[model samples]
Target: MSFRLNPFKVMRAVGIVAIVVYGVVLVTGYKKSKVTTTESVTKDMKIRNKDFYKSKDYKNNLTLPNQVVENNNEAVAKELEQTKPAETVDLQKDSDTSKQQTDSKVADKNKKKEEQVKLEMQKQAQQKLAEQKQQEKSKIAAKQAELKKQQQLEAARKEQAAAQARAEAARQQAREEENKKAREEAAKRARENAKKHQGSKKYIQVASVTTEASARGIAKKLGGNFYYKKTTVNGKTAYVVMSNMTDNPNTLKAMENQAKRAGSGYMIRSVGK
Candidate 1:
């Protein structure tokens, strides 16, 4: 077999070796740094732990008197439990006898004290009830007094109302009587005035005319004395007719009716007040 030199193979091998060497160097450096950091942290932690243990707080925590007492009691109880059974039974019987006597005496004292407390509470409750009843009596008396006063006031008001009603009735009756007297006096005066004017002269106007001939014609037709009342018509002289007849209401009404039947514009006129 002939040996051949391959440049590519050599180059490839060199590259692989370089890669492995770089990896080894990286791993070694990482391990050394990690170890140094770990050592520094451990040293600091040791120093902190030592300082803490030497502090007053650590001494106080370690010196627990209650824990030591509890341990001593536990050890003593264990030892007592390990004693001979015959001796334990005799000791237990004696202790039980003494405990029962003491319990009986304590129970008697508690019962007497409870009885006294109950009596005291009952006395206080009685006193409170009596005080409440007295207060109620006072309230009732005050209410009665108020009610009586109100009733008296109401009675007075009713009496005042009755007096006012009576006064009003009397005043109304007096006003009515005065009005009746006034009406009677007015009637008397009216009758006297009627008697005084019973003969007052009166006349009726027959008709109006422009000339004497027209006046005479109307007077002849109506059977009355005719006259002229000076008046003006279109700024010229005119005359109004008159009738010389008695002031009888019936005769005036008849004349008015006759004039109305003859013409449309005829009217009756009263003369002299």
Candidate 2:
């Protein structure tokens, strides 16, 4: 049997191998970078040490002459002192310059602190001003609100007063109209009384009862004075119950209503001699 390659399987295997190779390359590169970083650090340390030593050696070389001259016998001391005084002066000048620079830096720091304090004060002042303005605004708003409330109250009071005045005027006018009507009614009553005196006034005969007691009882129940007259009715003597009222229509009508409450039969008639 011959072994046949599946193209898909072959491609899958190739891809897996390629992936493995890429991962290995990435790992190797990372390790190499770590190693290179370490070597570079070591080289930098060595170079720094070498440079430090060289600087120290240079300083020592420069100081050798001074050391030698100081170590020499007293015969050269005076000569060295005269020769090195200028250099000592220069060193002193350099120290003085350094001290001045330090003092200048301290003064600059103090000036900066003062400026910060001034700025803070300005901010505080601004904040205070803002608060004052806000207070003023609040006061103004309160005053305005109070003024508006007062105005509204005044307006309401005025409206109420006007309404009351109008109601009073209406009541006065109604009273005047009622007075006029009463006066006219009094005059009319006077005229009617005059007319009644000229002739016999009308009266209502409420009932005809055989007994005076019955007549009196009905008149008492009817709440009015009554009189009786003997009349012949059906050839028999009968006592008629009559109300004492005038011919005025209102009086007759009132008596008629009262007689209805007393009994059913009633008649209107004029007074006789």
lDDT of each: 0.64, 0.68
What tens digits encode model 1's per-residue C-alpha lDDT throughout 1-273?
A: 223335456546655655565555555555665666566555433244557988885687578688886886788678667653321124344445545554555456555655655666676667777878988999999999999999999999999999999999999999989988888888889978876766554666666667867766666665544444678878886666665554566765665565555555545677765
Give me the runs in candidate 1 sitting further than 4 Å from their true place.
Answer: 1-124, 199-273
Against the true structure, what is each candidate's TM-score? 0.30, 0.37
The clash count of every prediction, one per candidate, is 0, 0
Where model 2 places Cα greater than 4 Å from the true spot, the runs are 1-98, 199-273
Model 2: per-residue lDDT, tens digit, 53-116? Answer: 5686556756788766556545455555555222112434444555565456545755665576
**TM match of model 1 to true structure:** 0.30
Lowest lDDT block of 10, candidate 2: 84-93
Best-fitting candidate, scored by lDDT: 2
